[model samples]
Target: MRTKETVPEEALFAHHQAAMEISVFGKSMDVLHKEDFLRNEEFCILVKLRYLLDNGIEEYAGINESIQLLKASIEAKDSFVIIDQTESRFRGGKQQQFYQFVEGLLTDFVSTEDFQDRLSQQLRETLTQIKTQEGQVALRNYTEQLQKLAERPLALKLLSLFKSYNLADYSLLRQISELVQQLSKKDVRDYQSLKPLIVANYRTFESLGKIISLPPQRSNPDTFMRMTQVLVLEYKYQLPFVQLANLLMVIKRWYQPYQNIIAVREQYPPHRYEQPPDFQTSIPGEAIFLKYKTWLTEKSTGVLFLDLGN
Candidate 1:
C-alpha cells in the first residue's frame, strides 16, 4: 500500500496563496457579471449582525425577539389565512432561521475581538496585495468596476460592515453562498456576461504558467491546460454537454496518430523487435521505420471555439 506523503509547509502555503488569488479573481468576475446586488445586501446584514454580537450591542438582542415573533406568526397559521400571509410567514421563518444560524456561527468561530481584528487585518492585506500585484491588471480593473457598482446605499452598508467585520472574508463566503443559489437557478443568461472575464482570467493564468515549473514527466501541465480549455468551453459556449463532447473528440483525435504504431507493436510483439538494428558497410538489411504525425487540421476544424473579443 502506498502511504500518503506529507507536504512541506512552504509548499502548502504557496498552494494556498495561489488558490486564494484564483478565488479572489473568480469572485470579482462574478460580481462584475451577475449584477445581483441583493446578495451583497444580505452579506452586509450578516456582517453587521456579527459585528454587533461581538461588541455586545444591546439592540442585537432585539433580533432574537424578532425571530421569536416570526416563529409565533408561523405557528399561528390557519386555513382561513390568505396564501400571501402563509407565504410571508414561511419566508419569515426561513429568514429567522438563517439569522440564527449566522449568529451561532459568529459566536462560535469569531468569538473574540482580537481574532476579529486579525481577520480584518488579513483581509485588508490580501486585498492590498491583489490590488498592487503588477501582473494582475485585469483583476485590478475588475475591482475598480465592482467599487463603482457598489457605490449605492446597499454598498454603503457593506462599507459600514467592513469597518467592523472583514470585507474580503465576508465577500468570499457571500460569493460562495450566492454561487450555490445560482447553480440551483440554472440561469444561463447571467453566465453569458462572464465570457470576457473568463477569457481575461485565462490570460492571467497563461502568463503565470510561463513562470511556473513542473517536472517533465508529470502530467500537471496537460491537466491544467485541459482545465483552462474546459473553462473556456463551458463559459464561452454556455452548453456543458456539447463542449464536453467536443473535448472528448479532441482527445480521440490526439490519440489517433499513435494508433497504427501501437497496432504494429502488438502484431510483431516486443520480443521480436528487441534486437538492436545493425548498420554495416556493404550490407543491405531489412528495416522497419515507425513514423507518427499530428495535423493541425483538428484545430482548424474548430474543436474549441472562442471569441475572446466578445
Candidate 2:
C-alpha cells in the first residue's frame, strides 16, 4: 500500500470506492470493479498495522506465546477460542466426558498406540519450518535421537497437547526454542510451568480453510498464515485445530473535530467519509470486553481480541 513516493497527511487518498470510475463491464480500459471483493480497507489496515508492527516488533517478538503462558497458568482446562463474526465455539478438551456430542479429539490423539511414531514424524516436519537458521543444529545437540522424542515424560505431554494447537504449541515451541538457545543445558522440565498448553477447539478444523480464505473483519493475518500452514499438515492428521494468534482493532476516537475535507465522485454528490460515526472503526472493544465480566466469564472466556489486549 506504500505509494511510489511519500504521501503527506494533507494529500487526498482515493481508492476503488472513493475514487472516480469509468465503468464498462468486463472490457478493456473499462472500470467495472466489484465493490464487495475490493480490499481497500484490508490494504489500508494492513498498511497501518504493518506500520504499528514495524515500529513495535521488539515488544511483541514473543507476544502470542507470552500471553498464552499467562492464560494457561490460571486456567485448569485447555485455553482456546475462535474469533469470527458468528462467535462459534470449537469443541475440544473433555469431549466424551469433555462432551458426548462428538468424538474426543484429545483422547484419541493422546491415547493412540503409535503416538511416538506420529510425534517423530511431526517433529521432523515442524523442525523444517522453524524460522531460526540454527534450529536444526540446536535439535541435533539437544536431542540425541528422534525416536525417543516423546519418550521424555514432558515431551510426551507437550506433543499430546500440540495436536490440539492452542496453549501447547506456542508455549512448547517457545520453551523448546529457549532450551535450544540455552544449549540444551536446561531440560524441558525447567519449563514445566507451561504445563497443559490450553487448546480451545472452535467449532472444527474444517472451518479453518474457510476462515483462512475469507477471514472475519477482525482476523489477524499472522493467525491466518499459521492456520493455513497447519492446514497442509492437518489434511493428513485431522488433529484438533487450535490457534494462538492476534486480532486487529482500528480505534479512532473523537479526539478532535471532524475534518472538513470532502471526497467528490461523478456518480454521487460530493460526500465526506473522513468524519466520525461513518468511519471504519466503532467504539473501542478492549475496555468493553474486559470490563464486563458478566459478558466475558472469568478464566472460562478470554478477554483479548484487540491485538494483545488493546
Candidate 3:
C-alpha cells in the first residue's frame, strides 16, 4: 500500500507533512503514518492541504469543497472506508469490525511456527555471507558465537521473538547499534543499565547469526568512535594525581622534540618565541610566566598534546 498506485497529490503531500511532524516529535513513523482521528480528521488533512496550497506547487483548493465531495461520494455509495487495526477503534455497533478482520489475518499468519523456521533459516544464510573477510572480525566472531548459542532450545525459543515480532529491518539494526554504542561508552556505573544492552546485543547477534555474518554499523559511526575513545581515555586516566603527573610528564617529554623543531617557511615570524610585551621586564615576566605555567600545569594532566613539527 505504501508504494502501490501513485498516491493522489493531496495524499502524497499530506504524508510528507505528517512524516515531518512525527519525526520532529520523535513519534513512531509507523503509528503516525496510519492514524485515523475521528473528530478532526478533515481538519488535520486540511492543515496538510493548506501547506501544499500555499507552497504554490499545486493549485490551491479549499478543503471545505473536498469534505463535501467526500460526503457526497459516501451518500452515493461510491466510496469505501478502510480502517487500520493499530490506530482505529470501532465501538462494535452493527458495523463489522474492519480492524478486527485485518488483525485476525495478521495474528493467524504470525502465529504459525513454520514461517518462523523459514525466516530463521534465511537469517542464518544471510549471516554467513556477512562473515566474509571484508567485514569486521569482532562482528564476525560475535555472529559465530550467536550461531552456536542458538543451537540450544531455550536460546532458540527466546530468539524466536525477532522472527515473531518481525523486527529485522534497518530500524532494528539502528536501535541495536545505538544500544551497543551506549554500552561501550558508559562507565557501567550502575551495572544494571549496562546488562540489558549487553544481553540484548548477544541475543541480537545470535538472531543475526542466522542471516547476517557481517556486523551492522552506523551509517556514520565517527561519533560512536570518538565517544568510545573518550571512554578509553577515562579508563586509562582514572588514577591518583602522582601517577597522572608522571603520565603527563612522559607525554610532555615525548612532544618536546617536535615542539622545539622550527619550520623553514620562507621567513620566521616576529615575536614567535618571545613572551608578551606586558611580561617583557624581569619582575612582570616572572609573575606572568608563573601564572601561565600554573594554568598549563593544571590543564596538562591526562591530556595528550601533539606538535606537528612546525
**Candidate 3 vs. true structure, TM-score:** 0.18
Candidate 2: worst-modelled 10 consecutive residues by lDDT: 78-87
Backbone collision count in every prediction? 0, 11, 11
Off by over 4 Å in 3: 1-171, 174-193, 206-310
lDDT of 2 by residue, 125-235 (tens): 555655554544443332333234334333333333443443322333333233223422322221222222212222222233221222243234444333222222222
Please give the distance, in angstroms, between residue 112's alpha carbon in candidate 1 and its true position after superposition. Answer: 30
Global lDDT of each model? 0.31, 0.29, 0.32
Give the candidates in order of lDDT, highest first.
3, 1, 2
Pairs with steric clashes in candidate 1 = none
lDDT (Cα, 0-100) at 201 in candidate 1 = 43
Q: Write the per-residue lDDT of candidate 1 for residues 43-112, one digit (tens) a residue.
A: 2233233334334354443233222222222222221122223223434333334323323333344323
What is the Cα-based lDDT of residue 78 in candidate 2? 21
RMSD of each candidate relative to the true structure: 26.1, 22.1, 30.1
Candidate 3, residue 168: CA error in Å?
6.4
TM-score of every prediction relative to native: 0.18, 0.18, 0.18
lDDT string for model 3 (1-310, tens) is 1322332455334434433432332222122222122133222333333234334222333222222222222221111111212112323321133223322333343333543454345435544544344332423343333344333433333233333544334343444445534544545333244444445455543443323222233212332232223232333233432343343343333332212221211122233432223122222122322332343332535321221122
Window of ten residues with lowest summed lDDT in model 1 = 284-293
